[model samples]
Target: MHAALTFLLLFLMAGTIVPVNRHFRQTPGGIPVFVVSNGVHTDVVVPLREPQTGTDWLEQLQQPQLTARFGSYGYVGFGWGSEQFYLASYGGNFPKPGTVLRALLPGPTLMHVDFYQQAPRPGKRVVALQISRAQYQQLTQLIRASFRPDSTGATVLRNAAGYTPEDFFFRGRGRYHALRTCNDWTNATLRKAGLRAALKAPLAGSVLHQVRRSRFHAAAQ
Candidate 1:
C-alpha cells in the first residue's frame, strides 16, 4: 500500500511540476512558426524559404540529393527520437515492447525531417506561433546542433530506409531515455527560441499543452 501511494504521488508530480506555460517575451518582429503533432509525436515546422535566399538557413535541405527526393516544399518539419523505435513504428512495424524499453533506457537517436508544401491545417494536434527573426535563427541553430555532422560539415545520413519518400532520417547527437525524450528536445527548442514551453516535457501531451496555452494567451491579447 505504501509503495502504491508513493508511485501515485510521483506520477502526479511528474505530470504537473513541468510548467505547461512559462512566460516569455516574443521577438519584436517575429515570424510565424508551427508546432505540429500526430497524437504520439511532435515536430517543429519552419518556413522553407524567405524573400532572400542568401540568409535562408534551411537551404541545406535544398541540395540536389535532398531536393530530388523531397521536391519543393514550403515548410519542413523536424523531429528527433530513438532510432530503433522510430524506424520500427514508422516503417509499418509496430515497435515491440523490448524496443520501447530500450528507448526509455538509453540508446542512439535519429533526426527525422519531413517536408510539407503547405502549413499543416490547424487542429487539436497543431498550433502556430509568431517569433522574431533572431528567435528563428536561434531555433535553427538548436536544430543544426542536434545533427551529427560528418567530416564534410554535413548531417550524416542514416543508411536505414525511411518510411516515406518525403522524409528521411539522419544520425543525431545525444542519447534518448525516459527522462530525456523527443518531446524534451522539442520543448527545449521552444525555450531556446524564447517561447513559452513546458519546463521539462517528456511527453507529447505536455508539449502540446504548453503550445495550446501559448496560442490562447496570444489570442486573448
Candidate 2:
C-alpha cells in the first residue's frame, strides 16, 4: 500500500510541470536528435555517426550483432527500463501483476534499442531537438556508459529476441523502479547533453513536455 501510494504521488508530481524548457534553435545546423515516445515510454534517438566529430557510435559501443545486421541504418533509438516489464510491454501485451510488483522494487534492467532507416518525423509523440557538437559528445558518453560491458569492454547482449526483427536487447546499467524509470533515463541523457529537459521526468509526458515547442515548423524537403 505504501508503494502504491508513493507511486501515485510521484505520478501526480510528474504530470505537474514546474517550468517549460526553452527549445533549441536549429539555425546552426546542429546534429539532429529526437526524443520519441509511444505515449508511455521514451527513447533517445541518435544518428549512427557524429557528422562533425566523425565518431562512429556503433563502433565505440562495439555492438557487433547490431552492427552486423544494421550497419547501414541511419539512426538508433536507445531506451532503458525494467527487464520483465519492458519485455512484457514491448509486445503490446499487458504485464502480469507479479511483474508489476517486481518492477516497483529495484530490479534488473535492459537497454531497448531500435534502428531507424530514416529520421522520424517530428509530430505528436516525437519532439525533434538539435544539439551542438560538444553536446553530442556528451550524449554519446552518457549512453555508452549505460551499457554493461564485459571483461573485454564490450556490451553484453541479452539472450532474448526483440519485438521487432531488427531491434535487440542488451544488458543496461542501473536499476529501474517506480521512482526512477525509463522516462527518467531519457530526461537524464538530454540534461547531460546540455539540452532542455525536465528536472524529474518520471513519466514520458514529463520529458516530452520539456522539449516540445508550441509550434513545430517541419523542415523543408
The best candidate in terms of lDDT: 2
Give the local distance difference test score of model 2: 0.80
The window of 10 residues in a row where model 2 has the poorest summed lDDT is 212-221
Poorest stretch of ten by lDDT in candidate 1: 50-59
**lDDT of each residue in 30-127, candidate 1, tens digit only:** 57678888777889998876542234534564346776555566788899999889878865778999888888888899998887888888788888
lDDT of 2 by residue, 1-221 (tens): 99989987876585537533445434346788899999888999999776787877678757566678788889988999998888777676889999889998999888888889889899989988766788788888898889888888888878446887867788999999877888989988887776777768888898888777423334621
Clashes in candidate 1: how many? 2
Which regions in candidate 2 have their CA more than 4 angstroms from the true location?
A: 1-16, 20-27, 214-221
Alpha-carbon shift of residue 215 in model 1 (angstroms): 5.1
RMSD of 1: 3.3
lDDT (C-alpha, whole model) for all candidates: 0.76, 0.80
Clashes of each: 2, 0
True lDDT of residue 65, candidate 1: 76
